[model samples]
Every structure is written in structure tokens, then in C-alpha cells.
Target chain A: MRKGFRTDLRWSDVTPKEKWLNRRQLMAGAGALVLAAPALAQGTAAPGRYSTDEPPTSLEDISGYNNFYEFGYDKEDPARLAQGLTVDPWSVVIDGLVDRPGTYALDDLLSGVTLEERIYRFRCVEAWSMVVPWVGFELAALLGRVGVQPGARYVAFETLLRPEEMPGQRGGTIEWPYREGLRLDEAMHPLTLLATGIYNEPLPKQNGAPIRLVVPWKYGFKSIKSIVRISLVADRPQTTWNMLQPNEYGFYSNVNPQVDHPRWSQASERRVGGGLLAPRIDTLMFNGYADEVASLYAGMDLTRDF
Target chain B: MDGAASLNGALRRVPVWAVCGLGLVPLAVLVWRGLSGGLGIDPVKTLEHQLGLTALQLLLAGLVVTPLRRWTGVNLIRYRRAIGLLAFLYAALHLLVWLWLDLQLRWSEIGADLVKRPYVIVGMLGFACLVPLAMTSNGWSVRRLGAAAWQRLHRLAYAAVLLAALHYLLLVKVWSAEPLLYALAAAGLVALRWLWRRGRSGTVRA
Candidate 1:
């Protein structure tokens, strides 16, 4: 949660000082004692291994299932359908207001950055969640390379559009080839990530393949997958969802429990397969990344702007 | 007396009820799994997969009945009703799982999904078409409708099968070879039926 703390060891290093007690193990051991004690004497339920200091239910579960329309629309469609995507020759074209505007190979983009294992809650706009351990450098670090001009107000992302490689493009389901955008400040948030992998493994093709953006605070779609282009522009870029249904999916698709999606309430999300025992947790404003990204939208009325 | 003896012989050779009972194994297994909580941690996904696969299997089985009957010269016509019914049963289960488990019985949301999602719409269409076919499968309805009308009504199953395949294909974002394979098989079956019908009509005209 610190702003600029750099630990010398690589994320994979199993250093004794770096390794902490597993929270799940601790909870399993102490849960019975806490349950037996008098109700008044008992403290709040001990946070589990993946628990963070962020406000309860505010932090989006980061590892939730994703429906990257590129792969397929089904929740598991990405995993099975994405396998056919060719990711080896992936390149991202950076254009618009930036000084350095050229296509960069995915390997070049990942070369110098240090990967950090950040565990964050990821809440989908569809109302589901999961805690994911993402392996990537901060989005701020990546954006720093492509110096933003003073007038630059927004960042636009474009996903791959080849029909041959992506059969979903052949259909007219969602206007084909997906696109997403974010405000420059939101794009540069420290918590935002240009993630290349998950669970320490190279991202499966269905999960955006070579590289995908992970904006924990925003709706999952805003974190575009199979990104092939990024444009720095003065005006807000037209996003896919906003284009499809502006009334439903606003340009600023931030996770706000108050602003219900036109069809369904965004107030709560099921933790996919969390079963009958685990209650659907209430969704948090800003997906529980408020302390980190709330100030960016502080004065703006999120309900109207949302 | 000869016609009566032939009719009696055909009825005696094939025990339609026993064959229909045998087809109930899959449904029994599905129910057992649901009750025992063997649907796994993600019951929705499990149910969806099972129902989808069962629908595919039943469709395949129904397609095979005609070919097998023609090749073996056996009274496979009797089993057609049972196969058609089983396909309807699995399709209904597929619809129910989506309704109860996926949509949580929220009719408004279900309506919205049907309207917005093309796959859901196609699936509903397929299921709706199967309803009339299943309803008229009985001997009484067949007798009332007559053979010509009955065959015309039952031809809707071909459309239902195609719609079901399309529904499966569109539902997934990525095209898995499995769904594509099923689609291809369904296409072949429908094509074969058309060809056979055309051949029979040509011979009759000649």
C-alpha cells in the first residue's frame, strides 16, 4: 500500500523476512476459539490470508472470472476459446498526443519493468468477484515511458481485430473488435496495471493472452484485453460499451454500488461458486480502491458522471 | 388377416416401452447427481455443461435412429418417439438450469437476457419449437393429425436441432472445436434427411 517502497528481492524470492504467516492457516486455527468466546468479547472476524487493510467490501476482488468479449461472452469462454489466439508476435501501437508514437513489441514493453505480486479484489460490472495475485508493474511506471502532454485528458485502448485469428469478430454480437478508454489520471493510477500474467503464469490466451490492462478500480471491461493500440487524446475516447449503450455503460465505468447498471443492481456481487454458505458481498464504491483512486474523481458527481 | 398379422408381428418384435426405459438412465444420473451435490463446487457450470452435452447426445441419437432403422430393416420407427421425448426432456432441463440456477428464477431478468442475448433467444426458440413436437408425439395426436400433418409438424425438430447448435455456438466467445463439430454433425444429419426425402419423392414420381 506504500507509494514508492522498493524491496531489493525479486517477487519470486522466498526470503524469510518477506514471507509472512499464511492468513488462511491462522484463521482455521483460531476460528473455533473466536466462535466459542462470548459475543461481546469477540473481535471482528479475523481477515483471511488475502485480506487487506482497505475498507471491507470496498476493494474489488482482483482475481474474479473475466468475460473478455474477444475470447467469447461466456464466463469460461475465454479459457477454452482463447487458446487459438496467436500471441507470439504481439505489438502495441502507441499514437496520438504523445511525443514517442510508435508500435512497441510486447517483450520491449516488459523488458525493464519490475514485476510485483499485488493481491487485489477484482469486481466485475456483472456483479462477481475474486481476489487475484497479479504479476505486473504499476501502470504509472508504464505510462511514464510515453510522456503525456499537458492537454492529454484521456487514454484509449484497442483490442485485436483480426477475424481469422479471432472468430468472434465474424459475428455482429458486440460490434466486433472491442475498445475501452480511461481518463489520463485514472490511467496513470499506481494501482492500475499493464498486467502480463496471473497466478505467476503467463496469461492464458483467453485472459487477454500476451498482455492486458488491469484497472482494479474500474469495471472489468475497462481493463481491455488483447490490447494492440493505446491512444493519448485530448477528449474522452469513445469506448465499446459506451458506443453500444451509452446510457448503460458510461465512459467512466467506475465501480460504484450506488449507480446501478440499467438492467441489474451493482450493489452486490457473487464471489463465483462461493456457494450457499458465502453470502454475496456488497459492492464498494470505487471497488474498494477509493483510498487509492477516489481523489481523482473527488469533486465529480459519480452518479451523474458514472 | 395378413395386415393384422403384420401389425401384430411388428408390435411383438420391438418392446418400445423397454427401450424408452433404457433411455431414462441419463436423466436418472442427472437427478442423482443434483441431489447428491455431485454437480461439483460450481453447480451452475456443471449443470450447464451436462445439459448442453445431453442435448447434443440426444440430438445425435435421434438422428441415428432413422439411419439404423433403414440399414437394419428393424422397426426403429417405434423408438423415434422415445428419442424425440428424451431430447425434449434434456432441452427442458437445460432451460430450467438457466432459469433456476443461472437467473435465480428472476423472470424479469430472464426476459431481459432473452431479449439482449442472441444465444438465449435462439435457445428459447429451439425449446419452443420442441414443445409442439413433444406434445404431438402421442399416438392419439398422430391419429388426429394424420401421417402427412404429423410428418410436417415433426420436421420442426430439424429446425430445433439447428437452432440448438447455433445457440451453443453463439453462446461461447471463442469457438471450440467441440461445438463446431456438433454443428457440422447436425448439418450433415439435416442434409441427409433432405436428401432421403428428395430421393423418395423422385422414386414415387417416376
Candidate 2:
């Protein structure tokens, strides 16, 4: 799977052009196919029309810093502890309110769709933000193929629960097999992706390997990781974070500066990769995807629904 | 028996300056890491957490001094003031990092956090309890306030440590072991002090 590279454009605009051109040339000659955790922004994934022009956070920071509590809670814990997680032989059980009610292999689910490179703004409920270049196809492509039933109103996702592999699950931090769901409309939105990889490489275990949901406009938690089961249900599913603290984390956890979490203000976010001293940027409504996603919540009060 | 006695005597000889200098090592390392880009991806959070954790650790160390003297006869009470001040130093730096670097002087956001965030309010109260203790951490202040009054004022440390632990517990979304352990330590030490007071009064009653 050759990820499209526009190195001559994105990084060239950010840093010196010659640097990226040279790096690309070297990577091309050196066999970039080995999947050795390729360096940051290497073979720059094409920025979607919605993706911000801001340079993607370094692949190291993106991969190393994560909140996949199935691995652990600390930002660094997932990277350190996500080892031994088995992603191969992976099949997703698509059941409940869907025509297709059987376990489908990861390859079978994604057999026909063309993978895209979507550089997206990822804002966590913790008020830390990052730009990621994800390699995947729209989730709606798979949902349409599965055939959502007439009664299906929400799309629920579940992460794998293997205590032997995921150490955090052994602890009582959260109920295992973390669950998240989105309204049917949000699930089928063009921007929603079921990411397979990042920075043009296969998904790292820490960053949700095999398959994961990516709702770019929403807080990062709404994008459940390392999914094993996806259900098209009639009612909204109880998401892990929201179930823990409903007032703090909403079901439709869209990134809104006005609705602050009880732990931290959402008005501004600290962008990673700036070391220690970079100033925080003002958070945008729907994480700057309001134009595309705002109408999904047309009449609903976000503050209340949030 | 001689070896244990000598080890205890050596520990007693450890000076206040050395204790403070050792306590400041984490701060120095933090600043150096911040400058050298070694503080990992989210350096501001790394800085804030390390500073806060170190402060809690130092407070725990200071609290353990009395138990050590009572149980083991280590008699290292002279270092208590330095340890308390060092904890206050890290707490101050932690708050500074949150205000200056993490928030970048977003006063409205800070105000919102104070009002809406339970953890933020608890942490502020913890730090607030430390303020008068920090100011009065001297021989002159003790003489001015009278020993009994000064001792009563310094009982704020008990409240401060509990608040700091609660603040940490609340900050984390889960009741994980790290914050829970800190909260337990804080509660255990305070309970130890209370038990000793009861023991002393029981002797008087007898």
C-alpha cells in the first residue's frame, strides 16, 4: 500500500523545501517499505480539504504519547505497555440492527474501499491537541456495505478485551472492552474514518492497531481504538468516558471551546511537539470542522446534549 | 546493634542544606530537561506533574520524620523545616507552570477552572494552606507568634497534604493506584499523628 506523498508541498511550506525533497529521495532509495516507524511527516500524507495546514505532530509524539487505557492511562503508558497486543487474526463482529450479523475479517470489511490520507486536527478532552495524517477509508463506506437496518439510529464501537495482552484491563481503572457510539448521521459522515494506519505505516499498537474509529471533529475519546465489535443499535450506547463522568464527557463529545470539562477548560489547547513553552491556541467549535459537522446537530443544544 | 546506631547517627548528621539541595535536584533536572527538550512530548504537563509529585513526595517525607523519631529513634527533626519549604517550592512552581506555560495567562480560563473544576479548587486550597506556613517557616516568626500559636498554625500542613492528595485523586478520572496511594499515605500519616495525641492524653487520664 503506497501512501501518496506530497512532500514537495506540505513540509516544503513549513521548513526548507530542499530538506524534505532530500529526505524523500533518501527514503525512496533506502526501502521505506520496511515499516520501521518511519520518521515524522515522512512522505507527507495528503492534507484533506478539511485538514488544517499546520504541520502534523511528529510521528514520535503521536505514537509515543497516547491514552489507550486498555494499555494504561498515562500518556506514555500505552506506548510502553501496548506491546504483546495481538492484532493479526483480527475480525470485527458487526451485529445488532444490521443485515450483516456475523464476524467479518478485517480484510473482508475493508476489501473494496480505497484508502485516503486525511491529515486531521485531534483534540483530546484533556485539552491537548495534535494534527495526525491518518491512512484509511471513510467509515460510511463499510456501513453502507453492511446495510444498516431501518431501526438503527446509533453506531456503537467496542475495543478488544484481552487481559493477557492489555495490562490496563487487568486493573479496575475502567470496565473492559471500552465502548463508544455516534449518531447514525455522524457515523456515516464523509469525515468519519476507520483509520488503519498513520504516517503511511500500519497502525501502531499504541495508536489503535488493526482498526479504529476516527471522528475528527469530536474529542479524541469519541474515536474508539482497536475495535473488535461494531454494532448498529437503536439507542445511543454508553461510551466509556461518558459513563465514568457523564457531566464531564458528553456522548456527542464534539470539541467546543465554550463547554469546558470539569477537569480542564476547553477554551484553549496545548499543542504537542512545542517542547515546554509554546503558547496554547484557542480551541474551535467542532475542532474547526463546524462547517462540515455543525448541521448534524442543527437544532440540538450542544451544551445540553454535550 | 553498633552498626544500626552508627547509621542512625550518620543520618542525624546530614545537614539541612544537603537535604534542601537534594530536594531541589528534581527541579533542577526539570528546568534542564525543559531547556534541552528532554521533557518528552507534552513537556508542560510533564513539568507540572513532576513538580507536583515531587512536592507531595517531600511533604510525605517531612511527615514521616516524627514517626521515624518515635519508632526508630532516628531523631532527624532538624530537617523538617527545610523539607516543608521545599514542598512549598515545588507546589509554587507547579501552579506557576499551570498559569504561565499551560494556560499562557488565560485568566478567564483559570477563573473558569477555579469555579468549575473541583481538582483545581482543591489544589488552590492546598497551595493556599501552604502560604502562611511558608511565610512563618522561620525562628523569628515562631518567637513573634508564640510557640503554641505557631504550632497550631502549622497544623495546616495536615490539611494541606490531604488537600493535595485529594486534588490529585480528583484530577485523575480513575481511582487508580497512584493517586489512591498518595491519598492513603496522606491519611495514614495524619492518622498516626492523631493516634499519638490520643496515646499522650490517655497517659494523662490514667
Candidate 3:
């Protein structure tokens, strides 16, 4: 597996004259492939079109700063404590409202899928944002494989909750076995990705190792990590954050500049890696994925759902 | 000379400059860590939070000065100016971090935060109270306003200290012992001042 295989194609496939003329331009764009992590060399993946022109955040920042409260409450806790977690031999139980209801090994479940790079803007309910380059397949493809039943109107996710591994669960900050769900339509949205890795490497334990959901249009918390159970249900499942503070965290939890958090304004968000003195940009409707996801909630009151 | 020696010998020997320098150690360490990439993933947020915490701690220290003088006769009068100024400096830096770094002078967002966020409002109120106190901290302002009026004006420290403590309490998501510790310190200092004043009035009557 040659690293930057796509980049090699740019030069070898081009005419000598053309390559010479576009050398500088090609070198600058070479950055996209050059910084890719080792697993990205698998060459079965394609770059996503919706990716931002903005530079990808450093992996240290992306993996180091996280909000998996199952590990601990502090942002740095996940990186520090999650190292003890064992991820191999992982499997997920896909039950409820699915015709193919059974436990499946993660590798066997994703065996036929092609991983793709998706650069997305992740907005936290706490008013901080990050641009992440995640590698995964669409949730729709996985659901298709599972064979959803007609009664299923939602997709519920559950996180691993071993107190010995996830020490934070010993404390009552949030309920054990953190759960989240998306509307059936939302679960099937092409934009919704079930990420298995990031920066081309297999997902680190801190970043929800092996598997996680990445719902770009929703708040970061809505995208549950280290998922162990994925249930297709007829009703919306109780989410961890929403259950903890119903007024502050909603089930939909879409990124909206208009609706403010109870304690803070959501009009703008601090970009995590944007450095000191970096101007906070105004948050976008649906975190700038409005065109793709807005119609899903066309007539519904976003404020109420939010 | 003999009578003056008996008044407050310990206070005369107070290491005011040494204490102020010691107070600055945390800020220096934070800057050093920030420059060397030791402040974890988000250095700016870390810096902002640390500065705010330092400022709140300094405000608590400043509040304890008068009570210490009355109760223990270890007057920190000479170092009070430095302590107050240092608190103000850190508070000012905290505000600058939020304004210039966090919000990037996004006035509308700031206005919204002030209106919607009670913690921000309380924090700003605490900062506002410190402004007049910081302005009148020096000898010239003390002389110009007359010592009696100056002392009366600076009593706003009590309100500022309480507001700052409340601001910190409200800012935290969970009810940790850390914020409560600061709040208790502020409350104790305020209570000590009240007890000292009542005792002094009893002495006057006697």
C-alpha cells in the first residue's frame, strides 16, 4: 500500500509538459495526501466533496481534546484515561425493529464497505467547534445491510460502560451506558457517517476507538462514541445529555445560531485549534450543512426540537 | 521612637515586594507553559481559565487583608495596593482573553452573553466594581479624594469580592468543592469584618 497513491497518479498520469507547467499548483495540493496517516494508504477510500478548504486540525488537538464523559468530565481526561481501554475483538448488537437482529463482529459487519475521508465541522453544545477529517462509511449503508423493519422510526446507539475501564461511570455525572438516537430519516441520511477511523489511522480509544457516529449537522454530543449497541426502534431513545439536562440539551441538538444555550449564546463558537486571537466565527444553521439536512425538518419547529 | 516601635513592628518588617513577586509566579508559569505548548490541546482556553481563577483568588486575598489586621494585628496595609492591583491586572487579562481571543471583539455576541448569561453579567459587574477601586488605589488619588472618602469608596471591595465568588460558582457546570472553597473563603472574610466592626464599637462604648 503506497502512501499518497492518489498523489502519485497526479504526476505519473499527467503529460510531462502538463506536469512541468502545473508543478507548483500540484505540490500545494499534494498537502491533502501528504499528511494522511498510515491506514489512509489502504487506497480503497476517496476524498469527500463536502470537505472544507480550511486546513485539517492537527491530530493531537483532534484526539487530545475530547468530550467522552464516560472516560471523565474533563476534556483531557479521555486522552489520558482511555488508553487503558481494549478495543480488539469488538462487536455490536443490532437488535429491535431490524429483520437481521443479532450480534455481529465489527469487521464482518463492515467487511464489504469502502472507507472514505469526510472533512466535517463539529460544533459542541458548549460553543466550541472543530474541523475533523473522519474516515468511514455512510450509516445508511450499514442500515441497509441490517435490514430495518417497517416499524423502525429511530436508530438508538449505546456506548460501552465498563466501570473498570471507564472510571468516570463510577461517579454519577451521567447515567451508565450512554445512549443517543437519531430520527429514522436522519439515521438514513447520506451525510450521516459511522466513522471507524480518523486521520487515516484506526480510531484511538480516546476518540471512540473502532467505531463512532459522526452526525455533521448536529452537535458533537449527538454523535455518540465507542458504540456497543445500535437498536432500530419505533420511538426516540433517551439520550445521555438530554436526560441529564433536558432544558440545555435537546434530542435533535442540531447546530443553530438562532437558538442559544440556556447559559451561553450559541451565535458564535470558538474554533479549538484556531489559536489565541483567532476570531470566533458565527455558527451556521445546521453547522453549515443546511442545504443537505434542512428539508428533513422543513415544517417542524426547530426551536422546539432544539 | 519607642512608642512607634510598639505600634506594629511585624507590619514594618512585612516583605511586601516579596509577596507580590510570589503572587506573580503562577502567571509566569502559565505564560511559560503556553509558549512551550505545555497547556494541552487548547492553550488559549487554559490560559483564560487559569487567569480568571488567579484573579478570583487574588480578590479573596485582598478581602482578607483588613480582617487580618483587625484580628491578628498582622497588618498587610503596605501590600494591599499591590494585591488589589494584581487582582485587577489578572481580571483585566481575563476580560481581554474573552474579548480579544474568545470573542475577537464580537460586540454583538458579547452583548448577548452579557444579557443572557448570568455568570458573565456577574463577572462583568465584579470587574466594574474593581475599576473604581483600582483607579483610586494610589497615594495621589487617596489624597485627592481625602482619606475618609477614599476608605469609604474602597469598601466596594466587599461587593466586588462577593460578586466575583458568585460569578465563579455560577460558571462551573458541576458542584465541585473548588468553587465552593473560594465562596466559603469570601464569606468567612466578610463575616470576620462584621465581627471586628461590632467588637470595635463595643470598645468605643466602653
Candidate 4:
């Protein structure tokens, strides 16, 4: 590793995001304000270790805008069309090279680990980005709970496929049931999260509902939303974007500003909630999470892997 | 046929400049949207798409002038030049928004995109086709170049409109009906003359 992915900054040294708020009434206004609460409840937890002190993106922008192709192609389509999606009584199937392989209810699967708030920098492959305050436990905790098999080298994730509610699926926008994967080491990385909430509120239907993965270092698509199936496999699994266009997207979609997408420049990004005032800010190495996740791809050339 | 002729005669009194001025309505809506919360989540993107769509829609409307005169006998031919120029204005504004607001004039990256990305190339070529047409959209230029040569030069609008539609269609990461519909409409407009002639050649006199 050129420079170690280690920050000397302690969790306590960094201020809690709540302290950054100018007004106390803002606490009540936190998270997405769209309609009522979601059907499922993962319950709230205390702030986590890796929470960024940066002022988070507004809940309105975070929940209102989305890239959920299952809902539709437009950013607004998810909010407009995904309201009817049924996320209650959800379950996730843990299969492949796990010691215990079975369908577990959403609550049971996420039962043991303590959920905590982690405000992270989220960068989309389209070169737009947001800093979301996500609430969840690390994927490592879940993998530990499920018990990874000896030969498992990769972790594949699949999103919930419900066509009747998701009209974009009816249009054959994708192959249906979007899939994503990560190397075993990447999956087990402490920074890798399976989020249940945003801004300490239950995730909205448009913003990946019951459960979603958040890999802060990678492009937003790599953090597959509304995940249902998680497989610990011996081989690297196919991903939706990678399978669609391998030239553009890659399995190791770690945010490297050096590598540019065909459509979007990875060198910089338009901040989603920054409005008209803010100019496009320069993108950082590993989206500024380089200190945390850089070691994972130590010797590999990201330009080639990307 | 008499009703169509009367409607066409009445349309002539509305003034071509008034119709061209009415094209600013969409831009006004855009301004209102930017002021209010209606520009959606990413306002830059919403603004860019709106301007681009308005340009395409106006270009298609200009294309329909001939078909309307031929088939329906509603001659909008008087307002065609104004409509075409207004469409060019919107297209230029769309390019400006993309450069200034969206890309922020990152010339090096923009140059790379023009070279590497097919959609960007398509959009650039479409805009390039409009530049000459827009520059020469004057009576003096028409007189200098002569009507025949000017008309030949103006055919670039067809290529520009088709490319604009294709740019939109290609830009989408997933299959979307909206862009596809626009593409289909553009294709129909581009082939309108040939399609109309083939259907009428069997019976109808010019």
C-alpha cells in the first residue's frame, strides 16, 4: 500500500453530526419528511465509530432522488412509483458457502449486531454524490453471525424483485433482480455496511426500503439497494452493471478519482444537495475513504481492475 | 378543406414573432421551477434535460410545418423560420447549461468526453449542425447564398433533430419509454416527406 489506509483520528476526537446543526428544531426535522414511517422497524441505535462530522445531505434530497432502476430510470421515478412497495415481513436468503444456509426473516438476520449511525460520503458512478447518515451494523458482523465456510472467497448480493409494484421491472429495464458482489476481504471490511435506515429513520421505499448495503469506498451502484439474497461463494459472482457493460463498470468499483467512467468524470462530482450555489467539487481518492479502504486493493492497478 | 384554409388564414394574423416569443414559456417555467422546489432533486440535471427536451420538441414542431401544410392544409409555413430559430436558441441554451452549470467548463474533461463518449459526440455533432443554420438564418444571408443553396444548408436541421433524439436515447443507462418515444417521433419527422409521397403517389395530384 502506498500510504496506509489508517487515520490517526479517534472516534471521540471527531464531533457527532448532531452537533453541527445550527438549530435544535432541526433534530425533529431530521431524515426524510416524506409521508409516514415505513412498515418495518429495525429500531434506533447510538452513533457508531466511523461517523463523519460533515453536515449530511438533506433528507429530502436523499429520499426524493434515487437510482433504483426497478422503480424507473428517472431520479424522481423511484419516489413517485416506489411508495406502494411492500417491505414488511421481509426475509433474506443466506446460501452458497455459508456454514448455515437458510432463509431468515429480516429481523432475525440482523438480530445480534448492534445497529449504529454511520454518516458516509456516497459517490454515484454518474458523478453526483451525497453524504448520507446511514444506520446499520458492519457486514463483517453479519458474516460472523452466519458463519462463513472455509472455501468462501467472494460474497454475492441480490436485490428483492417485485415486478407488480416495481413497474420498471415490467419494462425489462434490467434482467430483473439486480445482483452485486465483492471480494471476501472487501465484504469483511469494517467499513462495509448493510444499512436499514438513513438519518436514523427507517429507510424509505425509494431509498432501498427494508435493508441495503452501503460500501462508502465504492461507487453507489456497488452498494446494491433492497438486498434480499446474500451468498458467500467460492467464485466472484456477476453484477448487474458489470454484466451490462464490462468496459464501463467493474467488480471492484472502489471509488478511484483517477479512473473516469465513460459518461461521468470520476475526478469530480456535483454535490446533490449543494443546490445551484456550489460548483462541482473535486472527487477524492476512494471518495476520501482512501484512508479506510485502500489496503484492500494494495498491489492491483485500479485502472485495470476498474 | 375550406375550414383548413380559413384556420390557416386566421393563423397568419397571430404574427410569427408572437409564436416565437411563446417559446419562452418553457424557459419561464424552468426559472419558476428553479425558484420553487419543482426543479426536482438534482436541479442542474433537471434544468439540462428540460432545456434539451424543449429544443427537441421545438425542432420536431418545425419539421411538422410541411406535413401540416401538405396533409391538413393548415399552412404554418409562415412561422417555420421563427420556430426553427427558437429551437436553435433552446439548443444553444441547453449546451450552455451543460457546459457552465453541469460540467463547469472543465475543458480537458469535456474534450476527453467528446473523444471517448459516443453520446457526447452525437450531441456535439447535433449542436455543430445547428451552428451554421443558426448563423445564416437571415434574409440577407438567404439573398447572398440564394434560396436553393440556403434551403440545402437548412437540411442540417433534420440531421440535428435526429441526432438530438439519439443522444437522449443513448444517454439513458436503462431502457426508458420517454426517450424512445422522442426517438420514434424524430424518425417519423425525418421520414415524413418520403412516407407521405409514397402513400399519395398512387392517387392524389400535387
Highest TM-score: give the candidate number. 2
- As for candidate 2, its clashing pairs are none
Q: What is the TM-score (0 to 1) of chain A in model 1? A: 0.79
**What TM-score quantifies how close candidate 4 is to the native fold?**
0.88
| Model 2 regions more than 4 Å off | A1-48, B1-8, B202-206
- Residue A35 CA displacement from its true place in model 4, Å: 31
Runs of candidate 4 exceeding 4 Å displacement? A1-44, B193-206
Task: Write candidate 3's Cα lDDT for A82-151 as tens digits.
Answer: 9999887788999999989999888776777777878899998888888887888899999999899999
lDDT (Cα) of model 2: 0.84
Instruction: Give a tens-digit lDDT track for model 2, residues A1-306.
Output: 222232354423332435544554565568655432343434433334455556778788999999988887788999999878888889899999988789998878777667766889999988899989788888899899989999999999999989999988887858778999999999999999999888666788999997899999999999999999999999989899888888888899889998877677789888888887765999999999999999999999988998
lDDT of each: 0.71, 0.84, 0.82, 0.83
Interface RMSD of each: 6.3, 1.4, 1.7, 1.8
What's the ranking of the predictions by TM-score, best on top? 2, 4, 3, 1
Find the candidate with the highest DockQ and give its number.
2
List the DockQ of the predictions in order: 0.13, 0.74, 0.56, 0.60
lDDT for position B118 in model 4: 86
Q: Per-residue CA lDDT of candidate 1, range A177-273, in tens?
A: 6888888888887788886765444666777767788888888888888889989999988888888778878888899988877655676666654
- Give the per-residue lDDT digits (tens) of candidate 3, residues B1-206: 44434656855766878878988998899889977778877777888899999998898888777666555656567888899999999999999988877778889888888888999999999999999999999899999999779988987888888998999898766666788899999888877767767767554110
TM-score of chain A of each: 0.79, 0.86, 0.87, 0.86
Cα shift from native, residue B44, model 3 (Å): 2.1
Comparing to the true complex, what docking class would candidate 4 get? medium
- Which residue pairs in candidate 4 collide? none
Task: Report the candidate with higher DockQ, 2 versus 4.
Answer: 2
